[model samples]
Target: MPTPASPQRRIGVLLVNLGTPDSPQTPDVRRYLNEFLTDGRVIDMPAAVRYPLFQGLVVPLRAPKSAKIYQQLWTERGSPLLYHGLDLQKLVQEKLGKDYVVAFGMRYQNPSIEKALDELRAAAVDRIIVLPLFPQYAAASTGSVQEKVMDIVSKWWVVPSISFISTFTDDPGFIGTFVTLGKAEMAKREYDHVVFSYHGIPERHVLKGSHNNYCKLGTCCNSYNKNNRYCYRAQCYETSRQLAAGLGLAPEQYTTSFQSRLQSRLRDPWLQPYTDEVLKEMPAKGIKNVLTFSPAFVADCLETTIEVGLEFKEMFEEAGGEHWQLVPSLNSHPQWVEGVVNMIHRN
Candidate 1:
């Protein structure tokens, strides 16, 4: 028979997300990018090639340019992703009450996964539930967090029973919350089109991570199949479908696209129509007003704020489109808080 856990055993909840640098300076951005991009799971390159390429080339060339963008997005409260993560930890703690201890960590930067694990260990938690904040599973995002969690726990003398949520891309409550917010925004403005934009990853990286043969990189993701439905691209499209259904949106009025793809060329393709490309074509398509949602990101950050919000808006405007609105992220929405609490309790 399996042994029963001690009645006094405590449970810990660790919420993780891709991190942001502490400041908007070039040095800070360089360090943050170095740590983030250098991870084997993230860049998927050999250390010999990746290390020098990142340290010597990418960081030096990209940091100054990226830092300028971060500076525009930085606020008195610091990186939006980090602060929102902190706020979520506080709110989830309150909602879950004293039964479960909740903590937050960044996969790559400050308040890191190691530090979060230490906090839980110090509290002597008997069980831990790790919830990576990526709605969709990608090796470069959630997989990296899971790898770090295992790395930390493997070193512990008394490792706790662990439960990891790989992804919640189609969680009914999560989808409902997003739909509610998007609908609310649409009600306020008469947008001619609704665009669902999700963060992009290299196509090769995604195909490399898929466990099934279904992700053939083309029309395979248009319809969800039970086998590969859990694929990141499939789930992203499913997220859009559910949200669109909830909002009573017609097929012609809404479209799904990928955004923020890094440099890569592989025979297998990524989920597309790309966001920027779509925006540039909007005016010609007779879609003047647009509403965009970044469902892949639960918290507002550079990807959503600058990439989707400002950059896409500018592109649409430049292309002669009229209103371009971005739906706010699910920062601490009540239903989202409830979802976190439920996930903790259920595990």
Candidate 2:
């Protein structure tokens, strides 16, 4: 038997998820939105442009609507995303044994990155593995978390050695986990169409991040090159392809798309076809039953629950499609929890 090391070096694993509001109330949602949207990584605009637009327009206009959606998705245990993150932390700690410490934080709101880092410091950890749960890297998601981690630790009197996993979009373990879930769902009922819908970003934002001209907002992403492979749109498409291949899905049976666009006039083109548009057109394409997955998020959130599960259901049904099922997120799934444990050790 392999014996465990004595005095095993204490290590910290910080898992970050996109944040949620403190409460479902409008005020709380407004505050959460303010912090989230104002991040330069999220909105990618100067304070002169983002602040007034957020405060004067977005907060007042969006909070109520967004709050209503949050209300529908909130549970007795609070936001699903936050609660699932907490559960994953507990499961990872159990899997890693007593030598390693695990902690979780939301990138935006309560249980902030600062608190997570402080806990790691208190544990006297010699090294830290920072894992942002965004499977696909985007300036608005994974990049924001990286920026915040550096921002917070820079002020600390003592900082531990840290490593961050920017994206695991193509991890075989991750793809395998999703394939298992997809097959289980398929067994229940074979759907006519499958949609791999990811979160959307403005076209300009993607180009600004892309180092080359390869990502021209089309099927060019179907074939990627080293220079533009890091592009968010390209990565998302590649994720869809890998997951589809893992599930043995054919090209005609599935399609890749983007969702949750805030506005139309942001000027840069976003990934397409939009989810709502797909819903309206699927019936004509003889797509009566559909399966959708939100690979962008590792845990269930307002976007996955209310937006995809509820809102998309209504749109699909209204458009004359029969069945629309959203594959549940990999929240605290045993294999997924194991994947996290493996990732921490590998890091």
Per-residue lDDT over 1-347 for candidate 1, one digit per residue giving the tens place of the 0 to 100 score: 99987677678999998999989999999999999879998778899999999988988999999999999999999999999999999999998877778889999889899999899898888899999999888888888899899988999889989999988887876888888898789778788989999987777776775666667776777787676655888888888888999889988889889998766435545557789998999999889999999999999999999999999999999999998999999988988888878777777
Off by over 4 Å in 1: 1-7, 264-270
| Candidate 2 lDDT over residue span 1-347, tens digit each | 99877665788999999899999999999999999988888887899999999988988899999898888888999999999999999999999988889989998898898999889988888888999998888989988899999989899888889899987888776777888888999999889989998998888888888785656677677765676666898888889989989888888889888899977734655667888888889998889999999998889998888889989999999999999999998999998998888888778
* Model 1 error, position 257 (Å): 0.5
The per-model lDDT (C-alpha) reads 0.87, 0.88
**Number of colliding residue pairs in each model:** 0, 0
lDDT at 79, model 1: 93
Query: Against the true structure, what is every candidate's RMSD?
Result: 2.9, 2.9
> In model 2, what is the error at residue 157, expressed in angstroms?
2.1
Worst 10 residues of 2 by lDDT: 263-272
